[model samples]
Target: MISKQYDTIIVGAGLVGLATAYQLLKRRPSERVLVLEKEASVATHQSGHNSGVIHSGIYYKPGSLKAKNCIQGYMELIRFADEYDIAYELCGKLIVAISEEEVPALNNIYNRGIENDLKGLKLLTKDEIHDYEPHAAGIAAIHVPQTGIVDYPGMANKLAELICQSGAEIAFSEAVLGINEATSTTNVETEKHSYSATHVVTCAGLQSDRVASLTDRGNDLRIIPFRGEYYQLKPDREHLVRNLIYPVPDPKFPFLGVHFTRMINGGVEAGPNAVLAFKREGYRFSNVNVNDMVDTFSWPGFWKVVGKYGKTGMGEIYRSLSKAAFTRALQKLMPEIQESDLVSGGAGVRAQACDRDGNLIDDFNIVRKGNVVHVRNAPSPAATSALSIGQYITDQLFVN
Candidate 1:
């Protein structure tokens, strides 16, 4: 096998990994930073398949890593997009309380926005909501004028460009098999090569827990893949949404319900429901890998998830198989929307970490083993918070 040595080795070439590499290279230009990706090209997983929405850090609790990084990442991402000329828009999003019961939740979200120091956030009256999205059905709404979408794959590509220009190397289609953490360095063995780094920070995403296990620190948690299936509005129905439109999310479940997003490409997408995935990268029902399923089934964490979320899990499965049921849920926010208005858009698998006791890990959790740091849980806003998260990871590596 090809042998190499570097100052840092980042596994996974998704947005987070690329961002980590970019930030590390930016700090110590002479340091050799190597990034490895399993895909033939970059961003074939969550980073590329995401809704592409630039989060405003609204949903996250104040003082959390998600909240802090998202706000900072937005600013950094804006600068990066401007620098690279990536097509993006700061066109706002509307979060609507569709019923009387949702008013308090709407207020809570508004307050969270305030705590996160968001500017231009407006809690609109029922009548005032019409001026923003005429077709939206709601009793009250919160206008987040900072929420936007961009090309994340493009962002990863741009970061890769920056890394290359800084003399760091990226090796794709190389899957990490083992990581031996030593007192002073980490030895990483991939499918095609072996490398040693003084320090290693992984953004493994889908295989995060597994990567951490290789470092001997992921014993307490396991990654459970949750597939988020999307649907795109037909061309004729593109005018239905001017920007991002959302419903007040279900509090019990970590999912933000079906919503509409106008992508940078000038088309609209809707309905990304969270369902349990059969495989780590299963985007569809037919794409099952027996080994993945068996591994998940064998894990105690997966059982814990089943015990806790059995009812919600069944509901998600029901909606996944029934088109009419899914449409009925979608109609809660957009009553005018018909089943025919949507077609299958791409799906993204979320690498959600569950504790041994079966509790879902909601925030960004990083645990270190020896000289290696493993990113255990980094879901939705990870791409949005890429740069800031990158900076944070870099800080953690050198600072601590």
Candidate 2:
């Protein structure tokens, strides 16, 4: 029996889901909204596991959804943080091109930043690079003044509290197993109970494809989990990184290469190399799920990705296995950084979507069918773009 009917039912309690819920209630305070999370607490997955760097919208292509949302969301996020009294720092970040070969990509990123209407974006000379990061070594760099850091978990928890205060319900540990759409309403089935909703919005990160399939089975997109392994700098060595120091990423790869970020909670993080994960939630080499592995392996898109980027993929595996290899990548930016200065930190699994032809989606991908809307692909800048993405999704799904 359906226990109750909500005006809207949101799956996943990650930042995107929470932000969407908050926006929905802000627009319609009287609406009955229910947010269901499979985890015991909010922001338990991608939202909490991230590096906590507030993206600057510098890397995204102009006129893309990512660019528009990230630019607007960056401002919105700062406003929300100020209003809610969240601690954050606009400490800025440096995107360094260590070699001549990387200079072109760095220039392209700069051009994109200009096109995206970023203010105070400065191209730094080799000598100027050290002015921002005293020890950083690079042939060229871009100083993005808008980049910052914040406690996303703290922000998410606060948003959840506000959502609760708005009279919406957040049901923890309620894994939505199925969604059935009828003529009049959509029935969402969780492990313990079934509920109906006028509309359902799913921001399921790792399980996005599977959850979306429950509503629209014909979707060709699939989520391929890539585990990003990180290492924290020893307390004594934290001084090495003054702020966020990022390498000029390869255009071919969708993920930004391993770099350094100073966490809001203190300490520094380095080297989150993207390696294919056996399970959707796999955080370690040994944490494998047979079904998830088989599901990933069975996908033609997965094989296409492996076949095309086999060498790069193998390199990521090598970095994962060898701390020395990971350190060497970091050393390219900071020659003084040694493996001993690094200690094992946490890992975050990115739910990247791939098409049937094996093309990794480069931007946010969302799909809608009947009363159910699915956020199939949202990664990296997603945390930074949460509020804007929420507004967009809310407009698409709810706003007349």
Candidate 3:
């Protein structure tokens, strides 16, 4: 039996979900909204575990969803931060090419930035690179002055606060187990209670596929979990990285290569090697779930991905296991960085979506079935693109 009814019910209280709720209330203040989260507080997973970089829409392909949302969201985020007094900085960053082979890729990124209409993008020569980051070494680089860091968790929390202030309810520790879409309303069954809503939006992140499956069992996509591990520079060596120093990412893979970041809170963080995680939310190698592992191995796409990227996967696993290997990857950008200058940092799991044909979905995907909308894949720029994505989702929801 449904004990309560709301106009809309949102699953997951991460940045995207919270932003969705915020937008919904902002536009339709009279509509009843409820946000359901499985955790005690907001941003308990991917949203909190990120490196906190505010992407400048430089690396994404022109005309893609990631590029569109990121560029629009970048401006909206700055405006939101200023309005909310949330702490953030536009500290700028560099995408550096350590070898001559990387320059072509570097030029490609610059061209994409131009197509994306990103301003003040300066291409730097080997000598000019020092003008920005003195200790950094690169044959060529793109100085992206718009890239910076922010306190994402803080922003998420404030959104939640404003959501509640608007008379909406955010129920914590309520995990949605099933969904039944009827003629006019959908019944969402949770562990503790049953609720009904005219519409349901799920931004479940790690469990997005599972949540979507509750309504549409034949969904073709599956989320492949990849754990990104970080290492913070020792306090004494933090000065080596003035801002963000990134590598020319491997175009074939979605994971950005390990890099250095000057965090908004202070200090510096290096690395973030992406390796396959046995558990959906697993942070450590030893943190495994048999059920999650089975779900992963049972998928045909899993084996296909492994077969194609076996060599690159092995190298990332090697870096995850060996501190020396991780340091060497970072040393390509800053040669002075040694293993001793680093300390173990946090880890984040990315819910990368893969299809049965083994193609990794590279863009943000939002699909609507019946009255339910599922955010199937939202990674990296998702956080930075939260507000704009929220607006987009809101527009879709009320389009009729």
Candidate 4:
């Protein structure tokens, strides 16, 4: 039976979904909006699982969604955090290069930052780099003072709170099982019941492509799950990192390889190297779902994409198995970081969209038609850009 009718139904109660709901209610105060979450609570997935680094729009191609949205969203996020008193610190971050070969790309990022309207971006030398983080060692580095850390889960919860207060309902433990476009409205079916709405917006993180597939358009681009693993510093080693420390990312891949980041609450989190997750939400090396593994391997698009980037795939898989290899990658940036300085941390899976031609869609991918809007692909920095993306999605769906 249809549970209830709503003006809008948003699938996934992650930050993006909640923010979209909040933004929806902002303009249409009396609109009946319902938010659905597979989990029992908000941010149980990527939003809660990430390292909580607030990005500064670095590394994104200029004029792209990530560039524009991340830059714009960072400011908006900081303001929102301030208004709500969410624990956050603009402690700044550094993007460093250990070799002379990496210096060119490092400068490219610096220039990109300037073009993106990011301020206080400085090229730092060895001694100057030590002034902020004593343990960090870089031959040349780009210092971005705007990047910071936040409590993402806390922020997600607050967004949910404000959502409920604005008269929107968040229905948790409700997995979206189906999507049906009825005459005038779209019906989203959950495990429990059916829900009808005037418009439907989906922001499922790990399951984004699967959700979109049910709607018809997302089938062209399939979601490939890549798990990012982190390691937290022991209590004694918390003081080693004052802010965020990152590598000058390989322009070819989607993730920023294992870096050190300081969380809003306390302590430091290191790593988060991108590896293909055996399960869609696989946290541990032992956690494997056979069907999920078979499903991913079964996709022809996945094989095509993997075949095109076999070398990169080999490195990620190798690093995933060998801690020493992973440590070796880390030592390239900070030579002093011993493998023992790290301990296992939770993992977050990214829903990467792959096209039929084996190309990875780096930009934010959104499709809107009729009464439904699908977020086909929203990778890294989506959290930072949630508010703006939310508004963007709403405008696309209703505002034309």
Give Cα-based local distance difference scores for all models.
Answer: 0.87, 0.94, 0.93, 0.85
Q: Per-residue CA lDDT of candidate 2, range 1-400, in tens? A: 9989999999999999999999999988998999999999999999999999999999888888899999999998999999999989999999999999999989999999999999999999999998999999998999999999999999999999999999999999899999999997999999999999999999999999999999787989989999999999999999999999999987777778999999998999998999999888989989999988888888899999988888898999999999999999999999999999999999999999999899999899877788888999998899999999999988988545
- Kindly list the per-residue Cα lDDT of model 4 for residues 13-124, writing each as its tens digit: 9888998998889878999999999999999888888778888887788899888888878888998999999888888888888778889999998998888888888999
291 Cα displacement, candidate 4 (Å): 3.1
Cα-based TM-score, every candidate: 0.97, 0.99, 0.99, 0.96
Model 2: lDDT of residue 372: 87
Model 2: how large is the Cα RMSD against the reference? 0.9
**Which one is best on lDDT?**
2
Residue-level lDDT of model 1, residues 91-188, one tens digit each, is 99999998999999999999999999999999998888889998888999999989998999898888888899999988988999988877787788
| Ranking, lDDT, top scorer first | 2, 3, 1, 4
Better of 2 and 4 by lDDT: 2
Off by over 4 Å in 3: none
After superposing candidate 1 on the true structure, give the runs of residues whose Cα lies further than 4 Å from its correct spot.
none
